[model samples]
Target: MFDAQYSENVSHPLRVVPLSQLARAGGLGLGAERSYMAPVLFWIAHGQGRLSVGGALRGYTGHNAIFLPANLSHGIEISPRCQGTAVFFAEKSMLPFPPTELHLRMQGVQVQSEMNQLIEELRLESLSDSPDRDLMLFHRAALMLLWLNRQSGKPHVPSVQVSDMLRAIAQPKR
Candidate 1:
């Protein structure tokens, strides 16, 4: 159920979906097995659950963020009161974060606010029907990755890329 094929028909590769929305739409629920070609980030706003990644099962509580790398076997089962957001992007989308299971280290309130802001921006761009929404979402997600790295205290320094588009996304605006 986490296959990237589920979203292949869409215009862009980046997708930000609210967890509750997915639940209400019957897209996801308990006891579902899913593995994605793309990486996924789970921003748990509230509630607790157990998630298994690559045969390693871990439990998480409220206000936590988790990352599952591409093709990693991962899924979660939470109580009925869970609420959060999920971000899906291309397989190589999450640069700087590495291909590991990460429980993000949110150092302070300000860092948490920054993550929330990034998620909100992602939600907005995902909902917009503008022609440039794809490009916008890509850059926004890149920023989210960068911010996540910063929160982990091991930010990556991006190098030049194939095109200005990629370079722009890798480098924060000055």
Candidate 2:
């Protein structure tokens, strides 16, 4: 059986994995309607696919990000050309991530670039051995969630400069 409080208190807390890896093991049973204990976000870097969430089927193309809340049954059918990253967030994570499902089709080149950069940073953080790796991961994940919120028409907030964010995360957590 799975850990009872795993979603609430995962050791590592967050993960960033390539979509291919997610699709490798029978798509992690994603093809069949299922729910995760924690929330998951998928950033589609390329290609097209259809996602079924809460019994609603929707088609998505490249430059898209999909966020699904925990315990919300869903399934995905990604095309062979689809490319993306799957971001999993711990249930008890304090980040201000979207509380509902979001399917954002990023339109502008700048927006797409920002999303790409954010995902890359998350990927690097996930692979790093920094003493504050988990902390850094949470920080980057928060920025990404912010980006998604912005694209989804949430209230506008001052954007954090990359240099400032990097410097902040570099500081050792006390």
Best by lDDT: 2
lDDT of 2 by residue, 1-174 (tens): 112334534434677778887677554434677777778888998988788888887898999899988778888876656798888887677777786899998989999999999999998988999899988888898888887887799833444675588779999989
Q: Where in model 1 is the C-alpha error above 4 Å?
A: 4-12, 24-33, 92-97, 105-107, 160-174
Query: Which regions of candidate 2 fall more than 4 Å away from where they truly are?
Result: 1-12, 27-31, 156-174
TM-score per prediction, in order, is 0.76, 0.80
For all candidates, what are the clash counts?
0, 0
Rate residue 54 of model 2 by lDDT. 80
lDDT of 2 at 80: 55
Q: Assess the local accuracy of residue 127 in candidate 2 as a C-alpha lDDT between 0 and 100.
A: 91
Q: What is the lDDT of residue 12 in candidate 2?
A: 42
- Give a tens-digit lDDT track for model 1, residues 1-174: 357547654333677877776666563433565777777888988788887766667788877888777767666765568888888876555345543667874657887787888999998998999999877887888788877776666676665553566767899988
